[model samples]
Target: MSDKPLQRALGTTYRAEMSCGDLGKAIRQAATGPTPGEHTLREARVMQASLTAVGKEIEQQQEPTIAQELRTPVAAALADYAQDTGEILNAVNDAYIDHEDDGAWQDGKTVRMSAPLDELIDVLRALSQSPDAYADLRAAHVRQCAVGLAAVPSRAAGPTYTAPGRNCAAGLGYYDGIAEDIPDSQSKQWRSDVLQRLRNSMGTPPAYSTDPAQHITASWQRDAVRQVKVGGSGFLTDDSTRILDIWATARGDDLDARKLDALQEDMGSDACSRAEETTKQLACTREPSKCP
Candidate 1:
C-alpha cells in the first residue's frame, strides 16, 4: 500500500477523533453575530407585532398552563405600558390644545400660552429619560397628537373663519412644531426597552441544540404534559381535555378523536412492545437473585 494513502487515511481519522469542544467553540465563534438589539427599528417593529400576537394568544386562553401563566404577566405588563404611553400622548395633546387657542399668546408677537408649557415639557423629558415611563407614554403621545391635529380645523383662511396674522398663527403652530421634533430613535428605544422588560419578566427559553430545536422541544414538552393530564384514566378531568384541545388547535395540529386514538394505539404497541422485550431480555440474562 502507498504510504501517502495511508497517511491521508490516518489524517482523516485524527481529525475525526479531535475533541468536539474545539469544534463547538469554532462553530459558535463563526455563528455569533450582532445581538437582536442591533436589529433595525423596522425589524424590531415587526418582532414587536409578533410578540404582541403571542401575548394576545396567552391572554385569550381560559385557563393557562404553566408556560402560559409565565407569559401572561409579561404580556399584561406590555399592554399596560402601551396604555400608559397613550395617556402621556393625551396629556401632550391637551397641553397643546390649551396653549394653541389662548388669545393672550400671539404667533409671531413674542407671546406664550397662558398655561405653563414648561410643566408639559418636563413630563415629556422625564418620560424620555425613564424606560418604564417612556414605554408607558411614547405611543400614546404620538397617537393623541396625530389624531387631535387631524380632527381640528386647519388654520387655513376660509369663509367660516379668517386666518390669523403670523403672530397668532405662530401660537397655533406650536402644536405641530413641538410634535415634529420627536426623534425616531427615541420611539425605537422605548419599544426596545418594553420588549426587553417583557422578555425579562418571562424567563428566557432554555438553551438547547438550536433555536428551532428549542421551540420543538418546548412544543413537545407542552404536548406531553397535556397528554398526561387528558389521557390519565383516573385523573382525566375537563380541564385536561380543554388544555389538550387548545394546544392542538394552537399548534395547528388535527385533534380528531379517531386520529388521536389511532396514534395512541400505534405508539403504545410499538414503544411498549419494544420496552417489554428489552426488559425480558435483561431479566433472562441476569441471575435471578441478582435481578431481584
Candidate 2:
C-alpha cells in the first residue's frame, strides 16, 4: 500500500518485467526483509564446486553435441548462481548491521535471493523455448575456428593436389561467406585465396560448390565426393576444419561420421593415389594418423 519505490537494501535492482508471482514476491520481500539465512555459505560453495566439476567434465567430451553446447551455458550459470548465493547468504546473518534502518525487519536485509538462480532458470527455459539464446556463444566459437584457419601459413604458392569433386575447394568457398563479417582483413582473404587457387587449377565452373545455398555438394553426392576428397587434400581443408566449424556454430553435426571416415580413408585411394610422395607426406604431416 506504500507508494515508496521498493528499493533493494543490497542496492541491486532486478528487471521490472518479472512474471506475476515474481514481482509480487520481490515487493513482499523488500517490504519485509530477507528470510533467515537457511543454507550456509558452505552449502553454496559445495554447489559451486559441483557445478564447476560438471561443466569441466562436459567440456572434455570430444566435439560436443548441440545438446551439450546448450547444457554448457546452463552449468556456467548455475556455478555463478552458487557463488552469488553464497555471498548473499553470508551477508544476511545476524551481525550484518550495515543496511539496518527504521523499516528494516529483525532478520536484516541483503542482496536479492533469486537473481543468480533466475539466470540459471532462464538458461534452462531458453534451451527449450528460445532458438537463438546461445547465438553469441556459437558465433564466438566459429570466429575462433576462422581465425585459426586463417593463421595457417600460406602454401609455397605453387601447385597442390586437387581432389576429384573439388571437395577441398568447395569447403574453402563454404567458409568464405561465413568469415566475411570477421574483422581481420587477412582472415577474410585466406579462404578466398585458397578457393581461387583451387578454382584456377581445377579448370573453373564445376570446381566450386554448385549449391550456393547449401554451400557444398548435393546431399546425394556428399558421401562419395567427401570420400574422394578425404583421400586427398580435402580431409584437412574440408572435413577437418571448415565443415566442423560451421556445423558446430550452426548447432548441428550432420556429417560427423565423415570426419572419422576421412581420417580412416586409405592412402592409396582417390586423389592421393595420383599425388607425388612429397604431397602425400605433406598431408600426413598435418594428420599423422592418416600416414601410410
Candidate 3:
C-alpha cells in the first residue's frame, strides 16, 4: 500500500502542526521562490486524525512506545488549542457580564500582582534546572495575557468593570515585567495581533495608553509596518472561531442581535478604576473598597 511515503508525509504534517506552519503564506512565497512542503492548519488536522488511527493500530499491536511517539505532539497541540479556548471564554465572559453588582468584590489587583510575582520566583528557579520548561512556561503565560487582555475591550465598548481585576494597562505592565527574557521573535506577533484589537475594541475614546507596541518604540513600529495577512498562526489564529463560539455560549446560544446589544448595554460601567499607582484614578468604584 506504499505506507512508507504516507508515513513521511504524516511526519511532515506533524512538524507543521507543531511549528504552526502556515500554508497560504507559504504558497504565496512559493510562486517566486522556495516552496517547502508545509501543511496548512486544515491539512494538519487531517493528518492528525489519520495519525490517531495509526497510533491506535500500533498500540493494539503492543508497540506502545511507537504509538506514543506518533501521538504526543498531536496531543500537545490539541491541549494548547483547548487551553487557549478556555482562556478566551473566561475573558470574554467577564466583559459580557455588565452590572453594578458584577463590579462588587471584583477587585483583582492584588491577585494579579501577587500571582505573577510568585510565578516569577518559580521561573527564576527554573533558569538553571529546566531551561526549556522555563522558556515554554513563560511563553504560555505571556500568550495568556495577550489573549485575556485583548478580550476585555474597554470601558466604553462594554463591561470593563469585572469584579476584582487589573485594568488592561496594568495587565500589560505585568506582562512586560515577566517578558524581558522572552524573545521578541517568539512573543511579538501574538502581542501585536491582540494589541491591534485594543485600538478599536475600546470604542471612540480608546481605553489604553497607545498601541502596546508603541512601548517598544523602534521594534514596535517595524511590527506595525510588517504585519502580514489577517489573523495569524498558532494562538493568534485560535481566537478567530473560539471568540464567536464562546460569545454565543455567553448569550445562551441566542442569535438575537438586538438582545446581544441589550446585554452589552446592561453591563454598565460598574468599572473598577484599576490605575492604583498613578494617583490618576481611584482603585475601587464600589463601596467597601478593597482596591489599592
Candidate 4:
C-alpha cells in the first residue's frame, strides 16, 4: 500500500516461490507495521528482484510466431519513449516524498515524456495483470500518424477506422494528427514485410486457407494453369469468355483441382496425356509446395 502505483501493482501480484516468503504474506506482515527499531527493507528488496525477474524473463523469451514478430517495432518505439521519461521521473521520485503527485518537468531536464511515456507504462501495467500476458501475449502498438490528411479540415471531425478484425489484434494505439503522423498508415506495408519474413522462414502452409480476402500475400489466388493436349478431341470444347480468345476459366479461387479435372474429363480420355512435371506442376499451391 505504501509503494508507488507501479510498485504497488508489482507487490500485489502472486508468485509461486519468490525470493521473499509468499509475496502476499510479506505484504500483509509489512503493512501491519515493522517493529519500532527494525527495518523491513529486505521485503522491499525481494519484491523488486521478483518483479525484475518476471519482466526480464518475459523480455528474453524467443518470438516463434509471425504475430509475435510483428510486435517488435511497436515495442521498441515504446521503450525509447519510456527511456526519455526515465530521468525526469527518477529526479522527482528521489527528491519528492510524494513524487506521483507532481507531473511537472524536472529541474534540469527540458524534455518531459508526457502521454507517450504513459503509453508504455500502461502496457506493462496491463501485462502484469493479464491472465494470458505471460504465456501467449502478442500485442501490436500501432501509432498511426495522420499528416497531409490533417490539412483537410473535413477529415478532422470523423473517427477513422479500419475494417473489423484488422484492429482487433490487441493493438494499442497512440496517434498525432500532424506532429506525430508518419504520413502513410503503413498497415499494408507492414503486412507485406511481415508476410515476406514469414514466407522466407516458413513457406505457405499446407492448410493455408483459400480465401483471398483474408490472405496477406494473396496466397489463395495463385492457381497454376496446365495446358492439356487433345488429339482430335470430342465435344470438350474450350470456352473463353469471348472477350479474349484465350481458352481458360477465371483466374481466381475457383481454379482449383476439381475444375481442372472436370475440364479434362469433358475433353475425353485421349485429349490429355497423363500430367507430367515438365508440362505443369500441381493445380494447387500445396502440391507445388512452393508458391510464387
Candidate 5:
C-alpha cells in the first residue's frame, strides 16, 4: 500500500545481506556460539521468505532503478546460500558412498552423518512451494553436482598401486621453495646491499634470505591452521572422516565409532609416518620432507 513499508524492508535487507552489517554480526556470533538449533533454521527460512516476498513486491513498483537496487543483494544472498548448501549436500552424499564402500554403512557409521537429512528435506519442501523456487533449487543442486563429479579422484598412474594420486610432495615442495625465497631481514647481506638501501628507504625488506628455517617454521604453522579449516569447511566437520577412510583402506579395519578409538589413534600415527616417508620418497631432491 505505502512505499514506507517497501523502503524500510529494502534498507534492512541491504544492511543484512549486502554490507558487513547485521548478518555479518550474526555470523560472527554463531561462529563462537553453541551449535544452532531448529529455531535458528526456522528464523532463517522466515527471513529468506520475507525477502523473496519483498523482492516480488518491488517488481510491481514503478521506480525501475530503485527496485533493481533493492532486489540485487537479496538475490545475491539467496544465490550464495543455495550454492554453498548445495555443495555441502553433494559432499555429504559422496561421504555416504565412501562409507558404504568401506563397509561403514553396514556398521551404521553413516547414521549420524545422515541424521540431518530429514530436516533438510522438510526445509527444501517448504522452499519449493512454487514452480520458480523448484527451478532455482534444481539449478543449485545441478551446479553443485557438476562440481562434485569433477572433483572425484581417479586411480594413480603408478603400476603397483590402485590408490588415488598422492601428489602432496610436489605441492609441498613448491610451497617450501616459495617460503625459502622470502627474505629474512636479519641477514648481513640484506642489511648492507645497495638495492637493500633503496628497499629500506621505501620501508621494504631485502629480497634475499640467509635463514630460511625461521621463515619455514612460521609459514608452516600458519598454513597448517589455514588448511585444516579449509579442508573441514569443504568436506565435513569431523577432521578424522577422510583420514579414517584412508585408514580403513590401508589397515582393512572399518572404524565404526563416532570418534577415533585407541587402535584408530595408533593407525593415525602410522598414517602420519607413512605420509611423511612417502613425501620424502616422492620428492625430486634428497631432502628431508617438511611437515606443515
Candidate 6:
C-alpha cells in the first residue's frame, strides 16, 4: 500500500511500457507475472513492500555510485583545461622574461644580438595566437633552445653562446642600406639596423639536432611523478586530469579496472563505517540506559 512499493512497481511497468509501447498492457502483465530474473507477481509485491520500509537505506548505498560516475569525467575535463592553460601562460612568461634579459636588448641605447631574438619572438607569436596550441609548441621550443644552448662547445671561458639570426652578413648589409637611405631627421637608423639583422638570421634548427621534445617530456614526467607522490593534490590542483585520461586510455583495460576497483573499495569501506555508526545510534535510541 506504501508509495515506495507502488513507485517501484510503476517504474518496472514504465520500463516495460517504453520497450513494448503499451503502458496499460505492461502494467497488467507486471501485475500478473514476473519478468525474467525477477520475482513472481506475489513475491515482487512482498519485495516492494520490504523496499518501502528500507528505501532510504538503498538510496544511501546507491548515492556514491552515482556521484562517482558523474565526478570522474567532470573532474578530468576541468583538470585538462587547467593544465593546458597553465602551460601556455608559463611559456609566454618565460619567453618575455628571457627576452628582457638579453644582453643585446639591454643598455637601452644599443641593440646587439649575440644571437637574434627573432626566433624567440616567433615562438612567442605562435603561442600568443591561441591558448590550446601553445603547450606542445612551447614545450617543443624550450627543449630545442635548451639543446642548442647545451651544444655550444665548452671553452675555458665558460661556454660560447651563438646567437640565432646574427651570423648572416646579407641581413646586416640590408640594414646598412636602409640606414643610409633614411633621412637623418626622419630616420631611426639603429632600429632599421636591428630589423635588418633579424631578417637575415631566422633559420629553423634541424629537428633531429634539437630535442625540445625530450627536455619538455622529461620535465613533465618528473612533475607527474612528484604530483603522484603528493597524493595527487598538485596534479588535481593543476587540472592534469586530461593528461591522466590520456594515459589511462592509452594503457588499456588493466589500469581502468584497477582505477574502478580502488574507487569501489574506498566507497565500500566508507559505507561500512557509516552503516556501523548508524546502527550504534539506532541501538542507543532503543534503550537509553543500556547505551552506556
Q: Estimate, for each residue in 91-201, the C-alpha lDDT of model 6 and write its tens digit.
A: 332433453333122224322112122222222222222222222232333333333333434221211322211111112222122222223443343233322322332
Q: Which model is ahead, 4 or 6, in terms of lDDT? A: 6
Clashes (candidate 4): 2
Query: Model 4 compared with the native: what TM-score?
Result: 0.19
Where's the lowest-lDDT run of ten residues in candidate 2?
156-165
TM-score of each: 0.20, 0.20, 0.24, 0.19, 0.23, 0.18
Task: Summarize candidate 5's per-residue lDDT along 139-254 as a digit string, tens digits.
Answer: 33323322322233333122212111122121122212222222354222321231222222232212114322222222322222334331111211122233334333432333
lDDT of 5: 0.29
In the range 247-266, model 3's lDDT, one tens digit per residue, is 33332432455644454332
Question: What ranges in model 6 sit over 4 Å off?
Answer: 1-129, 154-217, 224-292
Screening candidate 6 with a backbone cut-off below 3 angstroms (N, C-alpha, C), the clashing residue pairs are 79-239, 115-163, 116-164, 143-212, 144-212, 165-201
lDDT of 4 by residue, 1-292 (tens): 1224324434545444443334434433432223321223333233233233333333333211112321332232223333222322222234323332232234352322222222223234323222122111111111111111112232122222211111211121111110011113533343334333333433241321342222221221121112212222210112111101111222233233554444334322211221121112211211334533
> Which structure is stronger by TM-score: 2 or 6?
2
lDDT of each: 0.30, 0.29, 0.29, 0.25, 0.29, 0.30
Give, for candidate 5, the lowest lDDT window spanning 10 residues: 230-239
User: What C-alpha lDDT, on a 0 to 100 scale, does residue 78 get in candidate 5?
Assistant: 37
For each candidate, how many residue pairs have backbone atoms clashing (under 3 Å)? 13, 0, 6, 2, 0, 6
Alpha-carbon error at 189 in model 2, in Å? 36
Q: Could you give me the TM-score of model 5 versus the true structure?
A: 0.23
Give candidate 6's whole-model lDDT.
0.30
- Superposed by TM-score, candidate 5 places the C-alpha of residue 129 at a distance from the truth, in angstroms, of 1.6
Off-target runs (Cα >4 Å) in candidate 4 are 1-39, 62-91, 94-123, 126-128, 131-292
> Runs in model 5 with CA error above 4 Å?
1-78, 87-116, 153-292
